[model samples]
Target chain A: MIMLLNECKIEMIRIFRNPYFVFWSLLMPIIFYFIFTKVVDTGVDDQELWNKHFLMSIAVFSVMGSAIMTLGIRVVQERSEGWTTWIKVTPLPSSSYFIAKMVGQSAVHVFSIIVIFIAGIILNGVSMTFVEWVSSAAWILIASFPFLALGVLVGTMKRVDTASGISNIIYLALAITGGLWMPMEILPKTIQLIGSWLPAYHYGNGAWGIIRGQFPEFKSIAILTVYLLLFMVLSIYIRRKQEAV
Target chain B: METIVEINNLTKEFKGKRAVEDVSFSIKPGEVVAILGPNGAGKSTAILMMLGLLHPTSGTVSLFNQKPQEQKVRERIGVMLQQVSIMDALKVKELLALFRSYYPTPLSMEEMIRLTGMQGSELNRRTDKLSGGQKRRVSFALAMAGNPDLVFFDEPTVGMDSTARKQFWEKVRQHANAGKTVLFSTHYLQEADDVATRILLFNEGKLVADGSPASIKQRLLKKAVSFKMDGHFPKEQFLAMEHISDVSEEKGRIVIQTEDTDRVLSSLFSIEMPISDIAIDKGRLEDAFEQLTVEQGVS
Candidate 1:
């Protein structure tokens, strides 16, 4: 327990200190929120509904960015730099290291959510009941699991540049198709079709559902769960394959 | 007495190419052993297998008479890999504390500092921001933090300057004196000769030689008997002798290359003319290392 906590403390510090985490997860989502709600004037007839929906979109966006970029890139860096090799020889078990990363990155995801949530309130004077606010945050945090798993897949990459490049591509694709930048109705049919299978789309939908006083769709929950397991299994399989050599 | 480490027929292959092949050795307690080899000579692979970082293709490694992966074995060892792989964004002190928490019995923070010669300000500074030498010191401290009974260092001084290098060996010697079994890998023959009680020389993924430093040098390196001749010398007589490999005059001195310098010296005394300033040169470890690796292809 002490070992896990110590590892977690360092992991949290490392994630929070990262400039990429700050720029992509916290700053970018807040920027996008303000641009859409305050300036871009997303051409929806029901502006109030759009405001609440957009707020949830960006909040989910914030956590997903942290989950993928921060977790993925740092793991790759550690692998290439040989920190993984050093730690293995210590008495610290691999499970402790893994749990620490999960817990620490989850904390970063929460921080990103709150920062973007505050930004949403400031941008449009958006008002909601305390339950709506808390539930939206909770939904986004829980929905970040699949993205975190995707980050693990990215972590298995051999080089940081490849991890960074692949993650950016996935991030942009997730944001665009998931309706975080625009409403799902505005996207092309093919993209929406692809988005339906992506955890990021369901991630935003769940948060948006919470803000609209509706339960997150059971289908969305199940799909995100499947993705989480899929990525987790993939990461394990690839890691084992790498080690078998 | 039990062996601290035992490897039987250990081998590792990457993509059908041999990285380590059918090699075996055991380590005893309180022995400072150097795994001396050129780069890509399977030094790191063997160490990784012993540390349980890399699985062997065939065979096994046991530490403290238990599998290397056993928690009981893990708690008794520390490692500093060839690469400087300390976690970035952590204070040096934080890393030490984190690694120390892994083992059941770890050195105190003050003791770690004293052992590695790390200062207070450096400890507080983040690891990524440290200079190369400082980072190595931090790595060394992390390796010692567990107060391990057995330690493995793979090319630990690759990037350190002279002072840091000197300090590193000093601390390593200190640990060895405390009766810890320390195994380090290096390409520097002089370092192996100077520090190790026993040297394991690897060539082309094979354990080419293993013995005391003196014995290895004596066995593989040629010695030279040289003298300033007092009169005309019978060079042909010396050259024709079975003990002498070559007899030539170098810088006005008769230099005789031979496997047995004592025999050459004895023969010199039998000469009619007296000799002055007689000297013998034991061949360098570099030659033996070169001889081993170059001859590996043919063997």
Candidate 2:
């Protein structure tokens, strides 16, 4: 556990030192939230609704950025550079590698969640029940695991350039179809149905539901859980094959 | 002495093309064997298989006479691959600490730094910021951290300059003298000549020759004899000497390519002319390797 945490902390330091994170992971989400909310205003008068919508969208963005972009790029680089092979040869267990990655992503998720929630409360004058805030933060952090596993799968499949491009596309697709960009209900019915099946849709909906003081249905949790499992299995299988080769 | 690594009929094929074909060798404790081969001669492929990074298409690899992939056996094996293996994001100290986690018992950071000759604020420097020689040395340090009984060092001194290379060899000798089994691969013949207890030549994924350097050199008994001779235009006499493969005269000197030193020396004794500055040299490892490789066309 100490090793895992140390690895995660080291990863966090790298993220903090990276100049790209300043614009992309930190400032970009808030900037995008403002631009999108202003350009498309749904006829909902309550300020709290806008706050909830904006907060959830930024939270999803944070999750996408951490799991898909940062994790994907780093993993691909590590693989190409033979860092993964060295670790495999070392006395370090493989489980520690994955656990460290997830722990790192978890740290990023927490930061993203807090930043988004605090922005909503301070700037948008959003009010949330104590239970709502705690539950929403918990769910946002938990949802990072599935996305992280999916990122690991994608990262292991392709080289760094392709992984970055594919992860970005996945992030945008999830953000758009899953109601982070626009409400899924507002889209065409077929698109809405497709959006419902997306993992990001379920994850975003789960977060939004928590912030609205509503109990999340098991279906959304089950969908994210299944997708997470599939990605985890796929990542493990690909990694093993890579090692064998 | 116990044999720590045994490879039996190991073969690896890539897309139906054999890279290593039925090559078998065993390494005993405290022995250092250098695998010598030209580029694309399957040295890297063989090393990869031995390190468990690549699986053999046929046959078996045993470490400590157990499966190579077995964790218990792997725990006693240390490897430094041909490529850079450190993460750029990690500081040197952090890197050491991280790698230290992999072994049940690893050398402490102080010992690792000392072994690699790194010290004084350099320990906390990020890996990417280090020079290539420093990085290679650090990689060497990591390879030694586990204190394994068997170690694989693949092209460990490639990027090093002469001074660093000498230092690296000293460290390698220290490892072997401490009773560790080391299998290192190098293209530099002299490096092998200086340290390797035995040298194995590989060509086209096959072990073409294996023996101590002296033994291998001895196999090519054709030594070169050059002498400045005076007072005789003895051309046919020298040419007719037994065991002399070739005779040539250039600028008052007679050069003989002969396998039998005694026969040639006796023949020269009969030449009553003054023999000045006579030099006889046995074949070198490089010459023998080139001759064998060329003869076999080990491409």
Clashing pairs in 1: none
Q: What proportion of true contacts does candidate 1 retain?
A: 0.91
Give me the candidate number with maximum TM-score: 1
Off by over 4 Å in 2: A1-5, A33-44, A185-193, A236-245, B218-299
- The per-candidate TM-score of the B chain, in the order shown, comes to 0.78, 0.76
lDDT of 1 by residue, B146-207 (tens): 88899999987776666767788999998999999999998776677788999998877899
At residue A60, give the lDDT of candidate 2: 81
Over the stretch A84-120, how does candidate 2's per-residue lDDT look in tens digits? 8887777666777777777777787788778877877
**Cα lDDT computed for each candidate against the true fold:** 0.84, 0.79
* Reference-based lDDT, residue B4, model 2: 87
| Candidate 1 C-alpha lDDT tens digits along A31-100 | 8777887888667888888888988888877788778888899899999999887777777888899999
Please give the C-alpha DockQ score of model 2: 0.57
